[model samples]
Target: MTTIRVQQHAFDPGAEINSFCARNPTSGGVATFIGQMRDFRGPTRAEGETVAAMTLEYYPGMAERQLDDLVKQARERWPLDDVLIVHRHGPLVPGDAIVLVAAATAHRSEAFAACEFLMDWLKTQAPFWKKEATSDGATWVEAQASDDARAAKWKK
Candidate 1:
């Protein structure tokens, strides 16, 4: 089973994960990743404007098609019993959950790896464009080299 959703409202990651596990009761392990909004900029920068909010934008059908392809790639690489991806768009504040990914399989290794793979792809390859609001002003977030490096590691 594979489930995917893109919405503008807030979601409870704990509830979503629990439901995923319940629906795949026979799977031995389930790994999940929840991505949330943050207040800071880069990892090493000690001084700069902090992010107050963010807005994600995308074309509905295009985003869904990209997500489906990502799931299909994950399934081909791992023997997964189920997968779930929930991503939010629109205006969001710091500490809001932006995305959730879960992978269930017969072993911990596959579950963990697949979950990580999905997250990496989502971070770099997903179709959504984001704009961050800071004390200075709102700016469109650009793709970072570090994110591209992480996603590239999974490529054959």
Candidate 2:
């Protein structure tokens, strides 16, 4: 099973992982990653800028198509039994669950790698535009070089 969802509502990552594991009974391992909103951005809280809130915007039709394509790519590269990706949009506050990625496979290595690959692609390639509301004002989030470097590894 391959599941992809993009919505504004929050989701329970733990529950989603448990559900994926239950559905893939034959799979020996299930790897999952949950990305949550933080109060600040940058490497450290001391140096990072504070963010009061965040809003994500996207072209729904295009976002769904891109997510579907990402899943296909992951499946082609790994022997996955099931995959799930849930991403949130719209207004969000600190500590909100932003994304969930789960992958089940017969071995831990494949499951781990698939989950990592999915997250890496999502962070850099996903079609979501983010705006951060700071004390000063709101600013559109820009792509970071670190994210680009992480995604580039998959190309090789």
What local distance difference test score does each model get?
0.92, 0.90
lDDT value for model 2: 0.90
Measured by TM-score, the strongest candidate is 2
For candidate 1, write residues 1-156 as lDDT tens digits: 899999999999999988999999999999999999888776743775689999999878988888889999999999999999999999999899999999999999999999999999988878999899988899998888988999999999
Clashing pairs in 2: none
Off by over 4 Å in 1: none
**Candidate 2 ranges with C-alpha deviation above 4 Å:** none
Q: Give one digit per residue, the lDDT tens place, for model 2 in 44-77.
A: 9999999999999988898888888988999999
**Which residue pairs does candidate 1 place in steric collision?**
none
Compute each candidate's TM-score over C-alphas. Answer: 0.96, 0.96
